[model samples]
Target: MAMNLPSQRGRGRKAPMADINVTPLVDVMLVLLIIFMVTAPLLTAGVPVNLPDSLAKPLDQDQKPVQLSIDDQGRLFLENEEVAETDLPQRLERITAIQAGGTPPQVFLRADRQLDYGRVMAVMGELNRAGLNRVALVTVEGTPK
Candidate 1:
């Protein structure tokens, strides 16, 4: 006397693959990388200053930076919002306090190429006066031949 059960078909076939196929994953990552590479130059800050081109090395991305933009007409902007020249120091202090927690604030200064050299210097002087010592001059990197 024995109990009988229906034998399943293909019972001994190899189990469904447990290994993940990484080919598609790699394909997706490569596509995303190419997209970022193509679009990165288009993503520069929106303030429309014609930055001077230079060979200077770029800043490290790990440090947060505050933007200070000077337009062709000598208008000042803090992160794209118009700012008064008279209010710069207090604004720098406030911004530094909020951003860097007492370390000297890193300011990326962008000035139009047509802007007067003296005006740029005066503005730099203002930033230095406000104790923002870590100033990075933002420039348009020239494309190579």
Candidate 2:
């Protein structure tokens, strides 16, 4: 007597898998990427100043440096904290002392495009008097006229 084996014609296709599905995960990741791209530009914190355009390349800024902002109205800010011109040197000295060892960190200066040349120079003079010698002017790359 011959025994009957299952025929291949009975199973035309393989059974569906019960594995994990990543479509939802991929969709969530894409949404997150788009959200980050939209909000990243607006997250920068600083006193708003229309910076003068330059053709210079951006610096290799990894560490957090002291920031100075000179607005169109000639108002001054040190790392988001407003400081008077008469007392800026004192504040800077205190900050330098806080750093303690090693050379003082460089200052990133952002001045408005409409600010007077003299005012910017005056701030530099005061910065020099405060022993903050390394100053880097921050400007955006200009577009063609």
Candidate 3:
């Protein structure tokens, strides 16, 4: 096998490549961006439920709101963790106590469409008794019928 040798003109060496190839970097960034985009919606809420559809406008939120979910079987979930009815009032009071300001924290209540009206009211009553009066019902956006 014949070996190739460096040329001896002046100092025999090839100068290091000064230009950076950004194509690989851009490709990697775009791949990461796509991965995040695909997974973002799935990460938004932990519990799954069949929500009623409504045409109401979405509310503007300045701070993170509390998530209170009621499943079809009438189970309550506060921030994805299950809590019993007897313990709900105290838990809500704790939430209120942890707030930094006088204004009560906003609560977004997500109830399954198949749940009984009274069951929803009972949970809402617990929230009311705990001084968490700022509550909004969460629903899927729907087209006008």
Query: Per-residue lDDT tens digits of candidate 2, residues 1-145?
Result: 9965555766655555679999999999999999999999887756898888888888886568899999999999998878888878888898778766877888999999898899999999887977889899998898623
Instruction: Give the C-alpha miss distance for residue 123 in model 3, angstroms.
Output: 0.7
Indicate whether candidate 1 or candidate 3 has the larger lDDT: 3
Q: Clashes in model 1: which pairs?
A: none
What is the lDDT ranking, best to worst? 3, 2, 1
Instruction: Give stretches of model 3 more than 4 Å off.
Output: 1-10, 143-145
For each of the candidates, the C-alpha root-mean-square deviation to the true structure, in angstroms, is: 6.7, 6.1, 5.0
Candidate 3 to truth, TM: 0.89
Going through the candidates in order, what is the number of backbone clashes in each? 0, 0, 0
lDDT of 3: 0.91
The weakest ten consecutive residues by lDDT in model 3 span 3-12
lDDT of 3 by residue, 1-145 (tens): 9975676774778656689999999999999999999999999889887789999999999989999999888888999999998889889999999984778899999999999999999899989988899999999999633
Q: Candidates 1 and 3: which is better by TM-score?
A: 3
lDDT, residue 83, candidate 1: 88
Name the better of 2 and 3 by lDDT.
Answer: 3
TM-score of each: 0.66, 0.77, 0.89
CA lDDT of each prediction against the hidden true structure: 0.85, 0.85, 0.91
